[model samples]
Target: MDEEILVKKLKARDQKVFQDFVNEYKDKLFRLAMGFVHDSFLAEDIVQDVFVKLWQNIDSWELGNAKLSTWLYKVTVNHALNVVRSKKKTSNVVDISQFVRESDDGGIEIQIPDNEKNPHNKLENKELAGILRKAINTLPKKQRIAFVLRQYQNMSSKEIAEVMDLSVSNVDVIIHRAKKNLQKQILKLMK
Candidate 1:
């Protein structure tokens, strides 16, 4: 469905449109949230909240200059940052593992190739993904967001710049630095 049509339906309070919107964007929004919040549960909550807010403010959406997706990304980033900020303010030190259900099916699985098919390659790839994630975590907030949007979401520098409300050149610089930092981190780990 075209975005303009979706927005029109959404503004008209069409339930089918709402469901379609969720089905289309939820996973991507969740992934983006996960890149910021780390915890799967928290990420899910943030995505849910973004949708709720979208529905609440549907009538107010200008839909003049930016695309609906750009609005959604901006909202996701703001809410995710708010969660991080609130958590920081509280300074809670609870061990997240205690809250996590460790049942075999219950965690966020980084899906590599099935180990049974190629155990060695699967293991190596999983290790590399872990290294990459850790390197991403070490980046400053802006750089991490820029890198995630560009790499994981396959967004163009211009798209990322709009999402982050930064200049295109600045987004490019941040992504460049993020790659260099990740490389350095990976090299150090290789030692």
Candidate 2:
């Protein structure tokens, strides 16, 4: 179903529409949440909470010049940030390495060059990917969100801006800074 139509139906409290909406966006939302929180269970809970909030506010949803997906992304980002803040407040430290495992089943796969026939290349790419992930983790929340949404999620700058509630130019600036920071971090790691 079209997003507008689905949203309208969603507002009407159509159970089938709700089911289809969840079926369609559940994984994407989960992946996006995981990208931020890096905890599978927490990501799932965050997405569930987002949908519940959406359901509760369906009637008041103003898709004004924004796509439903964009609104959903905004919601996901807000909730993910809240979870991160809550964790920090609770003095619980999260290990980045724990979320760096192989994404073979395709939940949060890092975009690394894969050469099955060449062990050397694969190893090199895997090492680079690890360094890249570390660098990404070191970025500020906004920069990290911009970089990951652009590079990992393949969202355009405009979409990222909408999802992040920033201007398009601001999104570009954030992405550029993120790249510069990542490059510096990777070079430092190489040293």
lDDT of 1 by residue, 1-191 (tens): 88788888999999998998899899989888876666678889999999999999999887685888888888897787678666532111222232234458776433444556764664455455445555566678888889878765789998998888899999889999988987876566533
Q: Name the TM-score of candidate 1.
A: 0.69
CA deviation > 4 Å runs, candidate 1: 88-138, 183-191
Give lDDT tens digits, candidate 2, residues 1-191: 77678878988899988988888889988888776666678889999998999899889876565787888888887888778667632111222342244666876643443477655664555455455545666788889889878875789998898788899999999999999997887666644
- C-alpha lDDT score of every prediction, in listed order: 0.75, 0.75
Model 1 poorest 10 in a row by lDDT: 89-98
**Per-model TM values vs. the true structure:** 0.69, 0.68
Candidate 2's C-alpha runs over 4 A off are: 63-65, 89-137, 183-191
For candidate 1, give the lDDT. Answer: 0.75
Model 2 TM-score is 0.68
The positional error of residue 189 in candidate 1, measured at the CA in angstroms, is 8.5
